[model samples]
Target chain A: MRIIDVHTHPVFMRRGLQRTEIDWLVAHGRALGIERMVTLGDVLLHGRFPTGEQISAINDVTAQVQSWYPDYFVSFCFLNPTLGERHVMSEVERCVTKYGFKGLKLEICNNASDACMKPVMEAARRWNLVVLQHSWSMTNIKQRSFHTDPADTALLARRHPDVKIIMAHLTGCGVRGVLEAKGLPNLYIDTSGGLPDEGLIEYAVEHLGVDHVLYGSDLPGRAATVAIQRVVGARLTPAERKKILYDNSARLLQLN
Target chain B: MLCDVNAFLGSWPFSIVPEYSAPQLADYLAQSGIRRAVVSHLGAVFQPDPMLANRKLLAAVRRTPALAPLPIVNPLLANWREQLTELGANAAVRAVRILPNYHNYALKSRRLDPFMDALAEAKLKLVLTARLEDERHRYFALRVKGVPCKAIAAFLARFPDHHILCTGVPLFDIQNLAEKHANFSSDLSYAENITMMEMLRDKIAPSRLMFGTFAPLVSARAQAAKLTQSPLTAQERKLIYAENARRFFSL
Candidate 1:
């Protein structure tokens, strides 16, 4: 079956930059039935809070990866929402206008429910772009001040209601994350990050509906084949598998 | 044959993972091309005395020859030597796993010296479980953490004669241990990355890294794909998938 990974960081920490590295990655992905991948940009390249220039540089790496194989890669503009409206709007405008990025990627910049996210959501609304928020169960991470927890992402979706929001890391978010995403049509969760814990994919599908689930491998930290197989190995029907691995992402990103 | 060094037969209470019976587990592993697995019981991890769960595990997997039972041994327990004696009765159990954090003991505990010596006497292998669930994703009420690398490193230094198969450890931990200790081999359940095999080749040898799937809790198919779908050569794949496990467990 065809697959589209909605979350990935193709060039992480200066790796996957060489021609050989990119070729091998694309080949590995293709062999595992990944026809397209959405690059989230190396958002943490500049650490939790990067300067405006550093954020731009990170997105540039994504743009370069997309250019290498435009047909296979979809770019997302990585943003530091804590940078306030002007900086947030400026970066989103530059990345979207210049690179035709299809989405906005939010890492541990600020909690998704924070006031500064106003500009980030506004930019998404303006560009008609998807917002993929990095979310985990901050019950232990204890960095909710800058980190986006599932509850915070749910609040962001409820707050916006108009913009599409994808909560990242189903494993990190766990059962509570799935429940947090339930009943919110605007909010979705991607299977990415950490170990491929069983029953999470099925739980997300049951609670959030199949359409709201997307396949993602926080690449370089996670593996695509492993991520894909997690969905495949789940107790879902074949149609549910296809929806997660391909249809949902394709529809979300308008990939025909 | 793929020998999964980290397969479980009982349920993890925190999640919805199926509690597999021996035959059901055998079928589950077979679906992922695993013909053999070193199995354990989750009851042992949480119970007051692991021997009850261990004996149950031995009986549970009796009909299913594909799964070899690896009983959990709590070294801190008063009857650890007796536990070994009872497990040694079967003579099929090649290894016994220890969950230090779950059992509320330190990997650096001096109790392990006598315990390791006892294991050596029985000719049973040791499987040190660094973790079961990822700490970041564990149940909010569960505060148990992964066994620390420093403790493991010190344990390895103290028990150089015993070749321990460390399961559920991350790839970097395996690399760190490989640099200083030659006696420990790790299962590739928690170590994940893009181009995983290629990344591992730089740090550890093919013989030192074995295949494992924290199945029932983790997807066995996905964990198997970590090796089968990688850049590993057939020889490297063979070693990791089953050869290393066979030699380590004497299967």
Candidate 2:
């Protein structure tokens, strides 16, 4: 099966930066039938809140890795939205003009529904970039103030209907997350994080159409074979599997 | 062929996982290259008396040779001796599993001393499950945590002669305990990572590592691919996939 991993950290915690390490990751991913990988920067390198320079350093690492294997890896600009419009705008513009970043990556810098995210979504619209937000179920974790819950992502999608958003971690989002993202046309969910729970992929496809679900491994934390087989092994038709495994992401990220 | 050491035959109460019958589970696992599995019934986890569920497990897998029943026992219960006596009578049963967190008993409890002795005398292998579901995403009301690594270390030290198979342990715990104890083996059901085999190469031997699919609850294909797709030699792969399980359980 042809696959596109929509979320990854090839340079996690400042590791995997060597030329040899980058080549091994490409070979490893290609051996599993992965055609392209969206490289999100080493997101928690400086803890939950990172300074502007720190954010640039992280994105620079992603750019450096993508430069080594440009045809194999895709780059995403990691942004901490709480740094206000000046910083967010400057960083997003720098990444877009300098590195050709295709998407904006938001971690636990702030909740998606918070007022600080206004400029982040605004930048996504101006730059014509898709927004990939770090999201999980906040039922057990009480960090909703800064952490983006699936419901908060849905709210962000509703508020900014013009911008497309990809919510990360289906297993972390659970059953309620699917329902929360049911009718939002601008919102998408990626299969990543935690263990691969049975029936969750089917549940997501049932609630949100097959076109809205994306495949991601959150790698170095999860394996590509495991993530691919979760969708491969789901009870979906060949056409649906084709869409989830490769076609949907290819279309959404304009890889075709 | 892969012999999963952690496949389940009953439903998880909190999720939409398939609760497979013996033959159904066997076929489900077979799709992922798992030809044989050491099976346990989830019904035994919550019921006040586990024998009812244990009896069901014994009968259900009686005709299914691909599956071998691993009954769960609650030593804290008064009739644990009788439970062991009855389970030991069945030749199909090669091991007995215990969930200390779910059964409300600590690993250091005085009750397990006699229970360990009974297991030693009976010659049935012991399987310790550290956690069934991830504690963070488990049912909101179920407030149980995984058995601590320190507790497992103490138990291994306490019974220095017995060899135990531990399921659902994370990679870090497996490494932590491996440095101190040599009497335990861990399943890769929960030890997930991109280069998992490479990470374990320095810390643990292939004989101490085994394949496991937390099936029906977790995806068997996903868990199997974690091992089958990892970087391991043919010999190391054989040891992890089936040979180690055969020598460990005498299958």
Candidate 3:
């Protein structure tokens, strides 16, 4: 099966950044039938709220990974929207122009519903870039102050209907998250993060349609084999599996 | 062939996880390359007495050969001996599973001492389920946490002779137990990491690890893919896939 991982960090917390390590990841991913990987920078290296320079350094490492294996990896610009609109706009423009970043990655810098996200959404609109937001169910984590729950992400999509958004982590978001992203045509979900719980992939496809779901591995933190297998093993039809595994991500990112 | 150490037969009260009958579950496992499984009834999870549900599981899987009935036994109940007696007599039960968090008993409780003795005497294995469902996304009203690590350590220290099989233990918790105790083996039902088999091999031996998909609740293909496509050797793969379970459960 051809695969495209929509979420990943080739350089994770000072690990997997070396040339040999990067090559190992590329070769390993290629062997697992992964055609391409979207490299989201190590967003947690400096903890939740990173400085502008730190965010740039994170994106630089992501760019480096892409440069090393241009055919295998796609870079995404990591931004902390809490750093105001100027920082968000400048970084998005720099990464897109300098590194050819295809998407904007949002970590837990601030909740997706906060006013700070306005600048982030504006950058996405101006650049015509898909926004990949890190989200999870907030019932247990209790970090809603900075964390973006699935509902918060849905609200962001509802507010900005023009910009395409890919909500990361289907397992973490659970069944309710799929339903929340149901009606929004501009919103999509990636099947990454947490344990590959049964029935969740099929549940998402049933509620949100096959085209709205994308494949992701959250690599370095998660295994490519397990993440891809989750989609492969879902109770989905052949066409649905094909969309989640390859076509949907290819079409979403406009990957050649 | 994969032997699913963790699977259920009835509907979970709070989950959208599909409930399957014995034959249906067998077919599901077959699609995931699982030839056999040890299954319990979800009805036993919430019912005041697990005996009714246990009997139901026994009757349901009677003709289904692929699914071996592993009934949940609540030692905290007053009629513990009768429950054990009934399970031992009718079903070809090799092991009895216990959910401490669901049954409202700590692993360190005094009652488990006799319960352990009874299992040893009965020649039935014990499967300690640390957690059935992830605590975070569960129903808000179901306020139960996993059995504590220290309690599991104490339980292992308490019963050195019984080689317990622990299901749903996290990867970190498995490492913690391996650091202190050597009397138990664990299933990789809830354990996950980037290079899981590589990391586990560095910390613990292959003999102590077994394949578990937590079927119907966890994706069997995802869990199996972890082993099927792992970087581990053929020998290590055999251990995780079936040989270890065969030796551990004497299947």
TM-score of chain A of each: 0.97, 0.98, 0.98
TM per prediction: 0.98, 0.98, 0.96
Off by over 4 Å in 2: A13-15
True contacts kept of each: 0.85, 0.75, 0.72
B77-174 per-residue lDDT for model 2 (tens digits): 99999999999999987889999999999999999999999999999889999999777666778888899999999999999988999999998899
Task: Report the CAPRI category for model 1.
Answer: high
Error of 1 at A40 (Å): 1.0
lDDT of each: 0.89, 0.91, 0.88
Worst 10 residues of 1 chain A by lDDT: A12-21
lDDT ranking from best to worst? 2, 1, 3
Model 3: residues with Cα > 4 Å off, grouped in runs:
A13-15
True contacts kept of 2: 0.75
DockQ, 0 to 1 scale, candidate 1: 0.81
Report the CA-based lDDT of candidate 3 relative to the real structure.
Answer: 0.88
